[model samples]
Target: MNFERRNLSDDQLLDLYKRLLKPRLIEEKMLILIRQGKVSKWFSGIGQEAISCGITAVLGKDEYILPMHRNLGVFTGRDIPLYRLFSQWQGKAAGFTKGRDRSFHFGTQEYKIIGMISHLGPQMGVADGIALANKLKKNGKVTAVFTGEGATSEGDFHEALNIAAVWDLPVLFIIENNGYGLSTPTNEQYRCENLADKGVGYGMEAHILDGNNILEIYNELSEIVESMRTNPRPVLIEFKTFRMRGHEEASGTKYVPQELMDMWAEKDPVDNFRRYLLKQNILRQDKDDQWREEIRKEIDDNLLIANTEADIKATYEQEVGDVYAPYDFEEIKPGSETENIRFVDAISQGLRQSFERHENLVIMGQDIAEYGGAFKITDGFVDLFGKDRIKNTPICESAVVSAGMGLSINGYKSIVEMQFADFVSTGFNPIVNYLAKVHYRWGENADVVVRMPCGGGTQAGPFHSQTNEAWFTKTPGLKVVYPAFPYDAKGLLTASINDPNPVMFFEHKLLYRSIYQDVPTNYYTLPLGQAAVLREGKDVTIVAFGAAVHWALETLDKNPEISADLIDLRTLQPLDKDTVYKSIKKTNKVIILQEDSLFGGIASDIAAMITEDCFEYLDGPVRRVASLDTPIPFTKALEDQYLAKGRFEETLKELVAY
Candidate 1:
């Protein structure tokens, strides 16, 4: 090693070399374990170790890293025990995630590293949020985020870069350009000459470096780290390298040509660095051999221990309780009294109450600050809370949610609003796959309230309006809330904001002005799983939530002769089953209604639960009334017919007469 060129001592170079070799050897052993059927499939960052380790070499001790699967060097660099890492790979209970996760899918709080989900794209935004938090705290530290050349094409990548650059956040975006996204080659992936140039367009200091040269990487990154610590700004560095193995050990590298393989073989990072140390005569043969022997034995023993350790067998009853932060709130208590307020205004009031109660609360979304959101629910928020607390994010749903998750991880309560509930589809991965599973797996706080204006009857077409509560209800680690009246909206949102778990708060856009009641301007919170009795009767029971609650009330009011028990289910997941059961038993004839598509609406789940629980109490078969199983059209007549409220009313009358 030419120590003078890199300004690194022999000991420092040796340490870097050891880190590079550890993951290489770990992968080699992991491949064996995979074939032995003790460990599952593994992602090998074998050829790209230099880039990861080099970046780790320059990271500040207190700084954070949002890492991808292939970045094994990050774990080693962070000083996570090898036994813990190996145990996790083998799904042992003693692992970081306690056997809830697998290979390269674990992180530790002590190290300030975040375990990445398979959809690693959104984490860019998450890292951006972490950097933003650091900036807000005036911490002179930086955050380093890792992704492959493939992940650079994701919208979150661009959105994160924009946020980081625009805010002058201290974040280092490291791209390991190994020329393939799974099986597709880089040439087929993008049109850019150099991926580093993308940073220049974003006004970031961009660099392209030889990823195989660890000494060069350490030397360059050291200066960049110093600059970042003093003057916070985003930087993008592309590490040009090649993947020597398949995307995973199981995914054979048949797509790679022998010529390309031979070409990259000449530049093998581990071998090149070893040769450099040998040439410098700095690698004492006896000491180096001793170190290797100890490493081999340590890895061998850890693998054996990991392969034999117990698997996780905890049930939901044991695991689900602590996923969210323990919120100290009550639903029935009155804070202040208000008369006749719109649902939108009530929601804003609830947010104001949250701000008053919690100093760490932050509200974020597109057009929310200046435009008061798409529905103007946050009309006076930006002016009251200032732009810092009431943030305006760009139109990136995935970033909005993931960044919220990041903020939550750092102890800031995040309240995010989606302009349209239908647009959450654009951010599906982070919400469903990442946020919904994070707390369940790692016992971390996934505390965030995603406020979405949903439902139809606005004539905004299919893309603008949707009832997506069912989508979140099925996702485990998330609490799904859909309130009916202005009272319920204000109460449930307040509760969701304070709860420790991630919540999908669905606000019906139509109900913002249409179906509202006199709501209290108090800071009371409703128990998440409780259902409210809007009306009590005996002939039939109508179970509904959000806009459907209003529809059910309308139907019952119109038909004075047909007495019905109307129940509004405020929270979708962690359902008020006891309330539902009592209502179904009292009425026997049950009707489930929703503004969502009937095919997979929450109504179906409620009906099925009713049949399973109250089968003998039934006076008639359960009836389901929901929107048509097609795109919500723009025309009013078609939309009115499609919602099937009349169909539900006819069914209600039939059941009443029967």
Candidate 2:
């Protein structure tokens, strides 16, 4: 584990030769298919096997490995069956993704390997979160991530490294600077002499090594692995190498100079390692000939079997059911009742009750630790559950969300607070493409809860006061929950925490204190996507959610002449179309009320659904009462005008008169 030079035994040298040759042999066969126009394309790791195999050589079988596109060496070194790998690239059912996904973007959970993300930076943050879980469990396993030089420019790179350094996470960042970000030269990409120096700015140590030499990579990573097992600090190392071929099979090496290419080909990792072994008398010429023949035969046999495997049927394609996690939770009956529980207190108590029930629950956000969160809803949680259970993250919204995803996939449920709903735009990639679709892609569970404190009435301007539920409501593969009262907030949150899918819990800022009700002290769970009929009337039906539920009640109370039924849609994605249709049948007049702006918001979706499902039942057109299409203002007077709370009253009167 020391940095000093050490001699390798004959057996160890032979092992390195095999690992180095495995990827090279497989890629050569794949390119032949590409040239024949059989295989689609390939991104070969021809000269970089030393770096990929070197990192995996030191990893424990139980430790997690997150790999990028050009890391077939990890698969070959890890001894993943060649037939499975071939079937995947061939788009056969025997593939890891059942032929639904193409390319090397697939992995087995049993092997502790995760597939690559196209937008690769967020995976680094996920690696940090997985290491956090290992630290909490007191398991001495380190997480390693592989990415290209160009990826370091992303903001997630800085956010991930800073958190790992400050939290002392056991994560190894392996950067392969192969002189190009797909045709863009290294000099044009970054001004810094070494990409490894970016780690120092984040308060972590870094090392640079010759990636073309397998011995150098294997030596330094072994030391880094041993040091991180007990001490657990993030370490970064840049593996300098060259891409021998074009970026992919179709793209020729026109941009790369012939002189540089020839120079790098002379020092190719696999060929160099083979020569070193030959000179050391480790492998005889006759034995070397047999080794190459055996590897070539294995590739041919696997490729034949993989091509014959069954393709996925169209009827069995991924659907809405596959998007969310498979779950079944019976409603818990409340054993005790409590009085005057504020909305915020109910949320805190609800989370506390979950900790007592489930052991894998952890809450995380920006200021949720000793300072007890921005709203103090999580006050005293750090002392009660400890910092490991209640984590305080840096002001990085995207990292925090993706980190929760990493934890969730590794068998932990993370409750992530967005601080404000309006800020979710900054983390859209991970939330929409990653967290939302992870289940559908590979059947991975994203069992994380995003607690979004949303809506206006606090005079918090557009940055903090905006209602953005419509954005998430439109996205598939996620459940959107916005509760009205303390009773519903506590009940719905409990159900959300128990849900197998990722649940978005929206808490209107105005309801935190202004709304209080008698909530049960004991735990209970309400059904998600079910509507609650606050008042039953025959004249008209007003469907609402979040703070709009309260406004609906106020409107009905102020105008006794307008007899209407107020229905609170507790969950938005699985909107209670059955309830809306039933109410519309009797009332014959409908109105949808929401806090979000008018154009292309939740109200628009509901109105469209009503017209499509129960179009003939309505006596009047579907009306909507919502805030005008503008950002919420700061001043209370202007905000009140912007919110237009009185419109529900006027709309209800006109509908009743109709």
Candidate 3:
């Protein structure tokens, strides 16, 4: 694949120069604003403006763009309002993120700009995802993702590029090789001679262009974008550019030697392009002056508008209530009519019903389709739904989750399987930076269900059997659900699939097949923040979630004399604190039970919340029955000790005695 340079008239060259200069001036003004305290911070693309403007110029306004922090020039060329960019730096509501995100995290669906920020290189995969969606929809649009050379070292970069190339998605990965990442030079970051060469390893077309030359970059990008639009394929272009300024306004360039600075300064993209325009007789001194004045006045006027605009305030108070999307869950009521169904069967049935109702729903993971997931929770799904809806992905956790995020962003309800919950570490980047923050940052719904078969007790060893729900439960903007009974499992899964936010559906491996209850066959759902009161009593309020809920129920059953009210918090993130507090007020005692380690587990969070909100209602110190702080052991004896089964019986008896 090659791009031929287009023969352009002098007028066209002049127009290109004018476009590049606007962003350069805007960046310069922003720097002045930062120094004057009007803007808190600024990242300049002084020497890299040519490549940024060139790429956007070549790409269509309808095509998607996932930009790095320093790609302000690209956004400016794409016509992202300069005032919105300025307002973002000033932490004002006029910004694209309404003062929620930092300045660089600018996105507008109207402009096809998929905003991503500051996570180094994960946006590459997200860009691939957008392209994948385009391919699926047969939309003749390419997705361009911008990153620095240093970002190439991230594992997500490799994963995204590999999948895009293999699938031949219409994605163009633009690496703004600014020679350095913060203080670390590209030479120190990787052994590769050229960053574009890395794309070849993924079997994608790779090109190295003069990032300082706007004409060269525009020529290459125009051809690539056109080719991708017609017969789409993934391509990587390495723009050999330089960061003339520090990484951000807060950074000091003292570590950079004067010699290197001088060397890069001589190759300044803005200056070189200006000289080129002059040489081509495209830009005269008078014409350049007139264009500069116009842009300066336009920026000044926009800045005034942005500064005077009313601020938009957002609070977590609204988010705390109804974190899950509103839906009629009455159709799928909780609790079973019969007592033979197991938790796993309920999960499978809930997913089956949800998928049947929502035609856009997709279920995928390693061995999930045919092998019925590692725990057999998704057994018979492939036979029921076929391969399209029940996809069996290769053993690539990162790829599966990242792809799921992409699908969800594009209006598909994707349920990604992590074989085991412990394996979520493999896809942590996508879960944390992308899926969790997508809504908060871009206001785009990340409606994906991540099914993590978690918890221990089947003697599957430390690798296969571990409860890591706490790891994700701590993250904001993500709902974590763990159902103890078949009824709760069915209801919660239905709620998760229908919800607008990303959900971490933790299915305890042991409880999946072990616990049995009667679940309704009809459509039903349980509200996200609603906790179930399994048994009503007045002695103590036993607050638990997931498998620990069963333990609480069993403990209550054993102690006939010691009456207790059991609250099963199916969702961990948007906790049913109202239910918890009400229960505490009635019982005047609280005990939190959890399956994960005692240190930093869900129990700890619940205990803190109860103490903060309902301390007067408590009769004694809130007790916590959780697993020991150690790795899940292989032996059954150690496993039993590590996990909190019915050992809470002793605690309940002690509490009653107290």
Which is better, 1 or 3, measured by lDDT?
A: 1
TM-scores for every candidate against the unseen true structure = 0.95, 0.97, 0.92
Off by over 4 Å in 2: 1-7, 316-318
Q: How well does candidate 1 match the true structure in TM-score terms?
A: 0.95
* Candidate 1 lDDT by residue in tens digits, 184-301: 9999989999999999888999999899899889999999989998999999999999998999888878999989999998889998888788778878777678877887888899
lDDT of residue 650 for candidate 3 = 80
lDDT of 2 by residue, 150-187 (tens): 89888888888888898999999889999998898999
Q: Give RMSD to native, each candidate.
A: 2.2, 2.0, 3.1
The model with the greatest TM-score is 2
**Span of ten consecutive residues with least summed lDDT in model 3:** 321-330
- Candidate 3 residue-wise lDDT, 1-658, digit = tens: 1222378777767767877899888888888888888777777788888877888888878877888777776678777787777777666776766576786775677777776667766677767667767776787888888878887888878878877876787888888888788999877999978888888688889999988888888877787788889898999998887788888878968778899889988887777778766765667989889889999999999999888987766677754433434335444554455556988888888888898899888887788877887778778878877776787765666766777766776667788888788888988888887788777665777878898888887888888888888888888878888778888888888988888788999888878778887778776888777788888888988888877876776766766887889888888877888898998999989888888889988788889988898888778888988888888899988888888774677887777667
Against the true structure, whose lDDT is highest? 2
TM-score, structure 3 vs. true: 0.92
